[model samples]
Target chain A: MIEQVADPLPQTGFAKVVLELEVNNHPGVMSHICNLFARRAFNMEGILCMPVAGGERSRIWLLVFEDQRLEQMIRQLEKLEDVLAVRRHGAEHEVFERLEDFFH
Target chain B: MMQMTGAQLIVRLLERQGVRTIAGIPGGAILPLYDALGGSELIHHVLARHEQGAGFMAQGMARASGQPAVCFASSGPGATNLVTAIADAFLDSIPMVAITGQVPLSMIGTDAFQEVDIYGITVPITKHNFLVRSVEELLTVIPDAFRIAMSGRPGPVLVDVPKDVQNQLISFTDFPPRVVSDSLPPVDAEAIEEAARLINEAEQPVLYLGGGVVHSGASALAVTLAEQACMPTTMTLMGLGAMPVDHPLSIGMLGMHGARYTNFVLEEADVLVCVGARFDDRAVGKAAQFCPRAKIVHIDVDPSELHKIKRAHVAIHADVGSALEALLPRIRKSMRKRWLSHVDSLRSRFPMQLPGMDDPRTHYGLVRAVAAALDDDAIITTDVGQHQMWVAQAYPFRRPRQWMTSGGLGTMGFGVPTAMGAALAEPDRTVVCFSGDGSLMMNVQEFATLAEENLNVKIVLMNNSSLGLVYQQQNLFYGKRVFASKYGAGPDFIKIAEGFGIGAVDLDQAANPRAALAQALQTPGPCLIHASIDREQFVYPMVPPGAANTEMIGG
Candidate 1:
C-alpha cells in the first residue's frame, strides 16, 4: 500500500476563487470533473455539489487558488461533453463560506 | 418495433456506422458480444495475441482510413492491457472506440473475478466513456461513442458493457441513423480575415502543419497556401506527409529531432501560422522561447488550444479545412523572393546530414534503401526510437495518410500491429513497419497474428542490442554511466520470426544486402528483415530536452 503524504507547500499566499459548473447528473460526472483537476495537478480547496433542475443536472462549486493555469483548466473543463457551462466568482461567494463551520 | 439482444444491437450499430473490420480478443465477460459479432457477415474480426495489439490495430485502421475504428476486450487484465493504446490514440487524436466487457452490474464493486472499473480507469485517457447500466442505454450510447470519437478533435472513446447488459433484451422503435462527425464549429470570418491579412503583410512567414491537416483532409489546401504565399513549410512528426517531403517549399519535420535549418527558419520567422497542431512540449522546446519574434496565427477545431501556448494574434476556432478554405480567397499571393532566398541560404548552411547513402549497412542508408525499393504508395509506420526518427528524416513520403506512427505518445511497440491494421484496411497497398529490436520485443507475439492474417507487412528490424535512445541519452546526459541500457544478450530474431511461421531474412548474412532487402520487401506475405545497427550512433541535431530548438548539438 502506498503511504499518503501531506503537501509540503501550502498555497496560502495565492488568492482564492470559486468556479460554478453546471453538469449533467450522472454516476461518472464528478469523476470526469475531478479527474481533470487531479491530472493537471491543480488543487481544489473546497467543493459542494447538489442536484438541480429536477435532478437532470447538478451544480458544483469548486474553490481553487487563482493560478496561471486556471484559464487553461476552465478551457479544458468546457471541452467536456457533459459540462453544460462554467461560471467564475470571487472567493467571497457564500456557497463554500456557508459550509465553513462544518469543515471547522 | 424491433427486438434484439444488446450484443446484437451493438453489432448492427457498428455495421451501420460503416465499420467493416474490427480487431479484438475474447474473454468470458465479452463472450456474448463475440457470439453476435461472429454472426455478422459484413464485419470481419482479426484476433490479436494481446489486447494492446488489438487496440493499436484499431488505431491503425482509424489513422489509415480517417474513420473511427473499433476494438474489444474483456474486463480486468484485458481492459488494463488496452490502456496504453487508448492513451496513445488520445494523444495522437486518432478516432477509435474501445468496447470492453465488465462483470455483471450486481457484482461490480465486490472485487469479483475478472472485474475492474475500466470506465473509471479510462476517464482520463478517453474523449468520453460509458458504463452501460441497462440494455436501453446501448441504443444511445453506441452512436454517442462514435460521434464523440470523431467529432471536433478526434480521440478515443470507451464503452464498458456489463455481462448482464449484453444478455439483456431490448426493443426499439427504430435504429439510430448512421452517425457522421458532429458539425464542425463555425469558422470565424473575422479571425480568418485577420490571419489572411497577417500572411499577406508578413515579410518572413512559415506555415506549420500538424496532424489536423491530415485529419481534416486539408493537406492540399495547406500546400497551396504555402506555395501561394511563398512560405517555407514545416511539419510535426504526425504531420510528416501533409506536404510532400520533396516539395521545394517543404522544410521537413521541426522540433526535437528536426533539421537544424528548420528550427533556424522558425527562429527567423516574422509570422508563424500554426494549423491543427497544438504546441506540444516535444514539438516546441521551452515554450517561452519558441518563435520569440513571430506573431502567431493558430487555427484549430478545438477552441482551447488557441492561446494555450504561444499567444495567437489571430486565434480561429474552426475546422482546419474550413478555415483554410475561407482564408484562401482573401489572401494575396506573393513571391517573397528575399525571404525565400534567405530560407534557401539557411537550408544550404545547415542542411540535414545523412551520413551514408551508398551502403545499405548503415542506419540512414538502410532507411534510404528501403525507400528506394518502395514507392510513395507504401504506408510507413514506425516503432518509436532512433529508427522512427531516421525514417521521419529519410523517407520521401508524398501524400497524407501514407505515414502512420505513434507521434504524441511515442509508444515503442506500435509498428508491427499498426502496420498489420493498415494492411487490413487497405489490402491493395504494401505497408512497411520500421522497428528497432527493443520495440519489436515488446509486442513480438503479434508475429503470429501477422502470419495468420497473411498481411503484406515487411518488418525492417534495426537490431542494435540495446535501447538505442536510452543508450544515447545516457551517453549524452548521464555522464556516460550506461547501466541497464544494454541487453545482456540479443536474441536470434530470424529464428524468432521463423518460429512464428513467418518468413525471415538476415540482411547481415546476405551476400548482397540491398538486393536481398528489395526482394524480401517485394515478396507478398509477412516477413522480417533483420539488420544490425551500431549502438554508438545517436539521433543528430538534438535539442537536449528543455532547451530552445535553435540550441542544437551535432548533426
Candidate 2:
C-alpha cells in the first residue's frame, strides 16, 4: 500500500505562461530554442512537442514562468529559421495540467 | 548522374557550398569520409591536434568570412571533444556544419566499442543533429544543414553518419537546387509606426545594439538610423565594434564591466531601442528594476527575444537590416541636446582610469600598448578571463567582426584556435589572440596547429600566474581563502611556445615589452608574447552578482 505523504510542491508559485510554436521540422530547431533559455538560466516547467500535418512542420508548447522576458522570448522564437508562428496562453491553458493528471 | 559512395557525396555537397576548408581529425569510424577527402582538392582539410581545436578553427573561419565552416570527427571521444566547440558556435551564433562518424547501424544502442549516441548527445547543443539511417539522407541532409546554419539566426548544425552509411554506394547526381524560403512575414506596419511614434515623442532615446547587427550585416543601417535620429547608442558585449568607438553617438559597451557612462545612459533613457540583443542578465542587471522608466523597443530577427527580459512597448519582428532600412525614412529627425550633454558629462566625470597606465607592465597598460601597435582593422580574438575584460575595456574596435570572444559561454582557451580559424579564413587580415595564463593552458596544445599552419596569428598571453578572475571572485565573495586559484609560479610560456615551434617572448624579462610585442605582431607566422602581470590584480568596476547595472565595487 502507498503511504500517505505530502508530496513536494514548487515554492515559487509563479504563474506559468505557455507558448505555442509552429516550426519547420528539423534537427537543431528545438536545440536553438532551448539553448536560448538555458543560456539565460531560464527554466521551462513543461514541454510538449509533436509533429503536425505530414510531419513537414511541428508544434511545440513550452510551459514557463510568466516573467518579464516572456514577450521578448516569443519574439526571439519567431525569428528562428524554422519557426513559423507563436501564440501565448495563460496558466488556464490546461496543456501541462492535463499532462500532469495523465501522469499522476 | 554518376554513381559514388556516400562519402563522395559528403565531399561534393561541401564543394557545392563553397567550403574551402574542413578542420578535423581522422579516426576509426570516420576513415571512409577521409578516403573521400583524399580524392578532393577543392575542399581543403585542416588537421587539428584535437577535435575541439578543429571545431574552434572552423568557428574562426566562419566568424571571419560570414560563411558556414565545416569540422569533422569520429564517434565517442572525438565527437565528445567537438561538443565544446559546437556549443561555443551555438552560443555565439556562428554558422558551422559539424560532421561526425557514428558506429554501424547494427551496433546502435548496444554500447559497442568506440561508439557513442552522438546524435542524441548533441541534440541539446546543436541547432540541429541528424543520425543517418541510410546513405540517401546525405543528399538532402548536407545541403539542408548548410541552408539552416546560414539562414536566420545562423548557428552550428550537426550531421552524424554511421560507418556503413558512409561506405554505402549512392547515385551521385547534379547538386540539388538550393532551397530558398522567402518565408519571413512582412514587417508589421502598425508596429513600425508605433516605434516611430515612441522615438519621435521620447525626449531621451537610446539605440541598444547587439551582435545581431553584425550577423545581419546591418551595422551601417543601424549607425545611419542612430545618426539620423540623433540618438545616443550603446552596445552589448557581443555588439562591440557595431559602431565606431570614436563615433559621437557611440557610447561603448553597457551592462556588467561596461563603461561608467554607458550604463548610466541606459538607465537614464526614456525609450531603449534594442536591436538583435536578448536582454541578457549581464547586460540588464536585475531585469525587474533595469531601466525602470524606459519604454523598450526591441528589434530582432527572432521573435523570442522581445519581452523575454524587459517588456517591450513596440516589438518589430523582422530581419534587423531590413527593419532598420524601413524605419530610417519614418524616424523623425529631432535633437536630444540635453541627453547628449548629460551622456558627455557622465563620460567626462567618470572617465575610464586605466590602473598602472604609467607603467607598461600592467594588463591595461599592455592592452593599450597592443592597441596602439595594431590598427583598428586588425581582428582581436580573446579567451575568457581578466585579460578578456581588459581587452574589451581598452582596445577600441572600430568595426564589426573585428573583435571575437566567447561572450555567452565565456570559454577559456577559445583564443588561439578561433584566431587560427580567422587567420586561415582571411590570410591578409592581422589576427591577434589575447589570452590569460589560465585560459591559454586550456587549449595550449593548439599552439602546434598554429605553428604547423604558420598562420599569421599573434597570441598576447597575459600571464597572471593564477586563475585570475576566479581568484578575484573568491577574494570578494568567499572570504579570500584561495583554493586552486593561484598556479604559484606558472610554467614558462616562452619555453612552451618554443616547444610548439612557435616564436616566443617574455614581456616581464624583456628589456622592452612594447618593442618585443610589436616585433612579434609584425612577424609573418604564429608567435606568442607572454606579458606577466601581478596575480593580485583584479578586473575592477565589478558588478557583484545579481546587482544592478548602476552598482559597482571598484575600478
User: Quick one: best lDDT, which candidate?
Assistant: 1
- DockQ for all candidate structures vs. native: 0.35, 0.19
- For model 1, the superposed segments whose C-alpha errors exceed 4 Å read A1-13
Candidates in order, TM-scores: namely: 0.97, 0.90
DockQ, candidate no. 1: 0.35
The CAPRI class of candidate 1 is acceptable
- Tens-digit lDDT string for candidate 1 (A9-101): 455677899999999999999999999999978889888899999999999999999877789899999999899999999978898888879
CAPRI-style class, candidate 2: incorrect
Model 2 misplacement above 4 A: A1-104, B178-183
